[model samples]
Target: MGLNANDRAIASFTMAGHALVHWFETSIPIFLVVWLAEFDVGVALFGIVVALGYAPFGIGALPGGILADRYGTKRLIVLCLGGMSAAFLVLSLATSIYAIAIGLVLWGAAASVYHPAGLALISTGVEERGTVFAWHGIAGNAGIALGPFVAATLLIFLEWSLVAAVLAVPGVIAVLYGLSAEFNPTAAVEEDVDAGPDEALSLSEFVSNSRALFASAFAVIFLIVAVEGLYYRGMLTYLPEILHGLAAIEGLVVPAGLEGIEPADYIYVGLLVVGMGGQYVGGKLTDRIAPARGLLAIFAVLAVLALAFVPVTGMGLAAIAVLCGVFGFFLFAIQPFYQNAVAVYTPADTRGLSYGYTYLGEFGLGSASIAIGGFVLGEWSLTAFFGMIAAVAITGALISVALLAGLDRFIDTDRSVNANADD
Candidate 1:
């Protein structure tokens, strides 16, 4: 079935919201590292500051999910966007670490409210959930991709204070668009999503419906998320620094302190940016292939690439960039697989809580990983940071493989029992 005009409008709003949210969220760090130097904060204090900003996205997931379920996703998204805008506006006035942390906490908490409700909205609204997930991935990656470039470019002319103000502009647009838009379930899907018995958005009655959602597949996905959380938050902390080191030969001027960031750092982050294209492609592939097979293969690639990253420099950085794109593409691209799996295996009533609790591991505990990255950065060298990231990647891959094996057994047993009942 084709998406009606209304469904397209909702999805478009959702997509725009995702883009603005991440654009503001991710770009903060690229400049913050430089910003901290002016305050004379050392590496340890800087790590804590970064953690304050980064950890909240994960921490707020459960509440965000509940909010999505209780109110409407559309409402939660509007509030979150508005809150995020306010937070950034506040950041413009921040002079001390505490003041900035206060702004970050608001931003993190507000930003956290969007994903589960908004994503759940897509799952319910769209006719083709797979394609919705793909578009969701693309929107997120676009935010991911654009954030650094925007941050870097603005730093060239605007003061960091103004940059913070600049980042808030998109949030205002997102909020306005979200508030003005009417949510039509069909936006995310071209099929009969509204015809489902349990499609109603009543959160109060959703308790019984939520339990079957905590399946082994979700547990496996969370294991994978925790690993990637560690890798992404920690290893990515050094991308600009690493690129600046390598780009010396390429004659890219590195950030002299914070003010001198070169085009290559922007370019390197842009490589991760190119990943949206790959993820869009990967999300389409997810619809065609079994997620277990696709996810396992991609995680394996990540383990190898993370290990190979150490020696990767110069043109080798190009190779690293390609693989990094592959890694980010599939790493997140597999999200809808787990999301749809939860929808398929669980009762519709419980999907919200299921999403809420499951994300406790994937998003909640996932927040803790940022703290770990901070710990590592505070205590260890760049080598130690990369080493830990690779180790987490290996751990994630192994956990996924084990989960896949168990899932195979569960599927076989279920099939056998159903066959006997038919007989």
Candidate 2:
């Protein structure tokens, strides 16, 4: 069905927001490579520094969700965009590692609010949830791919600091666009008793609401995403550096005067570009199949891919590139499944809070993988790194199985209760 004018506005606003959030996010790994060379810091220590920023990106989601639930999604999103831009501007002026860390922290805190606010807005406002999510994921993948592509391309002509400053420009424009855009944030949920933002929650009320949320299937969903996050952050954080060191890639020559470009950077971007397809497919599947069932299969595929990554790299560049593309496809494909699962398992009123905890698991606890990946790569082999991430994917798959089983039991019990009542 065609989206109404309001739905179209909401989708457009969110697509832009999702793209901007990921643009900064995916570009950070490129920056990580530069920081290693520029600051001459050890991998483990710098990983911790990077984590300092990402930790807040996930940790702040809870409160960000709370704020979205109180004041509304649009305001929090506007704050997010402005804060992210300012953070990058700060990074442009940094002269030391500590200053860089501070800028990243600001960026994390600002970008942290987006998932909850944007996803909640879509969940509650858009009449067509699945289609919007597909488009949203595609937009995010565009940022994921283009962020590194743009950052790398810019580095060819500009200094790193200037590139950082230039990166801030898009966010400012997005903030202005966000301010001018208009839509009904509660259009889809208006019929529900709990439609729209609510009064501020007291500390006790907050705790109670949280407890209620976790006591249901969402707790399992949280665990699943947390493991997924561990795999995601661990793998992607160091992938470019890992790829840079590969024999095949290292053996390739850059065209003259384009020496600044790393082949690994574009390869990384290519993987993400393929993820746009994965996102579209995954989003569509949500309407056709049980989300947990899809998650179970996807996680299983991820486990195999993770295990095969290192061995496949030995076959040649083409083989590894295909592997990376497939990995990227399934990697992002998991998002819409988990996102839809959150919407299915949680309440309408607490939609913002649910996504907050969802990201808290996905990004917060998952942020630890950054440090873990650094330590593993520093102390161990690429084989070890892939082995560890493979284990994480396996864990996610197991959890998906458990969630599916639980859901089936719940459905059966519900049917039994209805039949007994009728009797």
Candidate 3:
């Protein structure tokens, strides 16, 4: 079905918000290379510094959700956009590693709110949830791919500080667009029930709501999100560096005048570009199949990919590129599955809170992979780093199996109980 005016507006705004969030997020890894050289820090220590920003980006989602629930998504999203832009501006001015960490912390705190607020808006406002999600994921992956492309491209011409400043401009523009866009945040929910204006919850009420959410199948979904985060953060944080070390990658020819650009950077961006297709395919599958089943297969594929990545590097460049593309596809394909699972398992009233916890597991707990990946890469071999990644994906696959078997039964029983109570 075609989207009406409301759905279009929400999709547009949320798409912009989604893209901007990842634009800032994925760009940081590109910056990580520069930081290591400029600051003269070890990989392990620098990984921890990077984690400071990303942890808050994930950790702040809980409170960001509460704020989205209470104050409304539009306001929180605007704040998120504004905060991210300001943080990058701070990064542009930083003169030391300490200053860079502070800027990242600021950026993380600001960017953390976008997923909860934007996803909740889509969950509660948009009429066609699955389609919008596909587009949403596509936009996010666009930013994911483009952030590094843009950052790397600009770094060749401009200084890192100027590139950081230039990157901040889009967020500011998105903030302006957000302020002017208007749509009913709970239009979808209002059709089924009277989802009135959200009210602030007291501390006790907040605790009760959170407990109830955790008591449901959402708890398992949270575990899946955490492991997914670990694999994602751990793998992507140093992938460019890893690729740079590959003989096949470094041996590739670059077009003239762009010698400043790394071939591995292009490979990294191409992988993310392929992920856009994965996001769309995964989002559409949610409308047709059980998201849990899709996740089961996707996670298993991710595990296989993780285990095979190191081995693939020894192959020719074409082989490496193809494997990376496939890996990128499955890596992002799991997002919409878990995202849809959150909406399906939880109540409409607490959509923001549910997504908040969803991302908390994703970004918050997942941030640890940065440090872990860095340590493994510095002290051990690429084989060791990927083994850990494979382990995380295996964990996700197992959890998906458990979720399908257990949560399905629990949901049925819970629904029957609710029906009896209503009767």
Candidate 4:
């Protein structure tokens, strides 16, 4: 079915918001290479410093969710966009590593709100959530693809600071657009909309609700998210550097005018471009099939790809590119499935908090990759790094298998309880 005017507008704005927020988040890795040269720091130090930014991105999700639940999703989203724009402007003006670190922290704090707020909006606001989420994931991948591409391309011709400032322009536009857009923020329960913050769950009630969620199969879902986070952050955080090292082994070079650009940059961007399609397919599959079954298939693929990436790098550029496409496809494809999974597993009234915790695992625990990447690259072999990533993926896949088995039982149990309560 075609989207009506409201669906189109909400999806477009929300997706645009998703793209711009991610654009800033993903572009930082590209800048890390530049920072290493400018700051003359080791990989470990850079990783730790950058991880500071990443940690806040994760840590802030709880508060961001609470705020979203209290105030409204749209307000926090606008705050996110406006705050990120200012943070980038600060990043542009940085004169030292300290300043850069501060900017990154600010960016992290600002960026933190987006996932909870934006996803909450989509979950509550849109009727055809699967399709909208697919499109949203596609938009996010577009940013993921282009952020590095744009940053890499600009670094060749412009200063890094200037490029950051230039990138900030889009966020400004997004904020303006968000302010003017008339979109609905639907609550999971209609009465919840009229209820004030006072009516939100009390501390003990919140704890009880969380316990109920965790006691069921949703606990397995959270574990899967955590494992996926480790792999996701670890692999992507240092991907360009890893690829660059591989290129150096083969003595690869780019053409003139693309000087200073590494083969990894192109490959990384291309891989993410392929992820756009993955997002669409994953979204479609989650809607059309069972999410757990689909998740199992994708996580299996991710495990294989993580292990294969290093081995494939030795085979030459063509093989590496193909591996990247496959890797990127499965990596991103799993997202919408798991996101939809969260919505299904939890009660709707607490979805913002659920996503808050979901991302807390995905981003909070996921932030470990920064330190993991730093230490692995600084002290260990590339084999060890990929090995750890492979292990993480396999572990996640195992948990997902458990989730698949138990999903129906837990969901049915919850429904029966709710039905009995109604009667």
Candidate 5:
């Protein structure tokens, strides 16, 4: 019932690492508002600059995973933390928009190493997979919530560059902590630890495994993750702006204590804060139910809620709060399910690569949301923007249905092979 010492250690370090990764990733959006003012660029140009950083974060994942599988997960993680710390320090010295863009590209590449390394470490290393994934998702959402909250609070007094430097502190500390820590990844499930000659695949062998993974249920899972990434990146990139527009139209009152900060930002942060709970509940559900069933239910609700978000923003604060809370809940709640789905559907030997590809879709292709959001914002209305996101979510729901329908095939294939091997 209780996590052993090793479990606690692994969870603490991995969770801390995840939180810092998110802190760096999400903090950029908070600063983007300031960048626009300082640089005198419109949202479209700003989005391009932001995407420059984001695209590599996605692109680096594939290699990050390959390196993790070869060099060891701990090594890649330390590299990621140290690299991110240095990148943020680079960002703090920016004198021009081009300088800032280059720094973001550095940050993005460094940041890309995290998801594959961290998620792969946990998937293969931990036993209570769902709970660990849930806590991991919570840590991520905490970064999402706090990154902006901290940036906003500091911006009230400090300059943006100084704020960027201060944010680097956690990454530095995490790197130091990682250096002195030890791990026992050998204590994982029997199959993972004993994955035979294919445990560490050669490049050609890895290519073969990757192909097989895609040909099976994992490909459907990848598509679902891609859709989720698009929706997530597209909407969250400009949620504060979207909410600001709605609040202005509906005439919502700002609290006296928070009057100095934008009301929409507070609402944006509040929604993410609420999503922390969603991560917990979603993690729990993964342990109790089939992950596909959970994915189906979550995607379906997300489709409805995504469509409803713009309309609800005009209804009043109560309606906005309720819908946003539900929306935030489901948004994060799906993480563990899909993460769990990856492990269930892939081989023990290639788990690291599996997560690498998973996040490749989740963050890599997901990075396009910045440009997509900008284009829609520049050319279309918020209603149209959210409509497109809703369509993607609905598409993910259909994919989930396919995953569920094919579940038996996935299970039977595994059982049949194992039975033959035993015979």
Candidate 6:
């Protein structure tokens, strides 16, 4: 099914607008650390607060997917952006730590709507689904890359409140773009497919039990992807503190010295950039090479880097940083892989539920990593935490490799038997 001119234009617009939303969300992660400093809150308390901000994303994403499936991707996106903008506006007025939590939950809820809509749009609209998925990834990575830089720059002169208010302004343009574009998913799905609201899962039960994923072949792949999610998020959460620890050990003091750098503070910019670079490279890799092999190699390299993260020096840390980029590249770039794979694996009518399940792996499993990483970090030094991270990456790589291998063996054995039958 070839997409018409209008579909192409809408896809591009949605992609661009979603990029801005991602930038706003991904970059502000560092804000928690900064907010703690600004408000003089306890680190443990702030950790919990930060964790709270992330927790809802997994919980909300499945519901968000359902909304997109039922309501229309475009409308859900517009509403998501509008709601997100409001959340940021709330953030701009916040004074206390609890206010930050309130603002985050609001923003996170809005964020939950985007992935399923965006992924579904890409799946249905694009001819070369992998390429479209890659572009979606690039948009997301670009936003992730830009977020910290923007947030860091904003903090130099303005209050966090003012910064958040200003951040909400871009979403206005996105809302306008969505509204003026004459494409709303909700109306279109009804007109086109005639899907109903009664089919909608009961909200409370849906929210409470969505994480209880059903077991299927596709679901297993999602589980592997979810494990990857845990490593991906876990690695990002602690890399800053880990890198800074290495720098301190190396005595490679910057112009400002140790005080100049803070925990999870100094490396935010580096992490974002690395992730972006990784996605760019990963995009090319996936398009040129098999997604299976590409994912395997990338995860393998990531395992090594995670293992080597601590107990390394100047050149070593720099090398580690670059590998981190590779990790981000393959990790995020492969998102499109799941999008493509799931599309082919599942029937069209139930695409929303399929995509939702995939996200359950990505977001839900990924969220668990925060507490896991935190506990690991507390139990053993950054070095030990990273070792565990490396092990997780190894597990992911093994799973991806095994999946590809099993798929190949099944095909090969089938071919031989068929050849003998013909003879």
Write down the TM-score for model 3.
0.91
* Candidate 5 local lDDT, 1-423, one digit each (tens): 777666677788889888988888877877887787788677877787888888888889998887776777788888999989898898899978898899999998988988888877776677665567657777888888898889878887789999999999989999999998887654565564655322466779878878767755677778888888888887777776677667543375657765556656667778788888887788678768887899889888888998997778678777887787888888988887887676676654455577778888988898898887888877888788888888888898888888888754753234112111211
Deviating ranges (above 4 Å) for candidate 5: 123-134, 185-200, 247-259, 407-423
Across 313-348, the per-residue lDDT of candidate 3 in tens digits comes to 898999998999998888888887887776677643
For model 5, where is the 10-residue window of minimal lDDT?
Answer: 414-423
Over 1-423, each residue of candidate 1 has an lDDT whose tens digit, in order, gives 776666687679788888877787678767665565667665566666666776677778777776665566778888988998899888888888888888888887788777777777876676655555557667887887788888887777778878888888888987878777875653544454444433454555454344334332444555556665666566565556445556433554456665555555565576666666556666567557655666667667766766666666535545656655665565555555554444443333344465566555554465555566656656875566667777776776676677667763453222111111111
The local lDDT score (0 to 100) that residue 357 gets in candidate 5 is: 89
lDDT for model 1 comes to: 0.65
Q: Rank the candidates by lDDT, best first.
A: 3, 2, 4, 5, 1, 6
Q: Candidate 6 regions off by >4 Å?
A: 1-4, 40-44, 124-134, 184-215, 241-271, 287-292, 313-327, 333-344, 347-349, 405-423
List TM-scores for all candidates, in order: 0.82, 0.91, 0.91, 0.90, 0.88, 0.79
lDDT by candidate, in order shown: 0.65, 0.84, 0.85, 0.80, 0.78, 0.64
Cα lDDT, model 6, residue 366? 77
Better of 1 and 2 by TM-score: 2
Instruction: Please provide the root mean square deviation of candidate 6 (C-alpha atoms, Å).
Output: 6.2
lDDT of 2 by residue, 258-305 (tens): 887788888899998988888878877877878789999999999999
Off by over 4 Å in 1: 127-131, 185-211, 215-217, 245-261, 313-349, 407-423
RMSD (Cα, Å) for all candidates, in order, is 5.2, 3.9, 3.3, 3.4, 3.9, 6.2
TM-score of 6: 0.79
Expressed as tens digits, the lDDT of each residue in 1-423 for candidate 4 is 887666676798889888988899889988887888888678888888888888888888877877877778788899999999999999999988889999999999999988888887886677666678768877888888888999988887899999999999999999999899886667334554667543556688778767766765566778878888888888888988778778543487667776666667788888888888887788678657666787788877887887887778778888888998988888888987777676666653444577788888898889988887888888888888888888888887777777777754754235112211211
lDDT head-to-head 3 vs 5, winner: 3
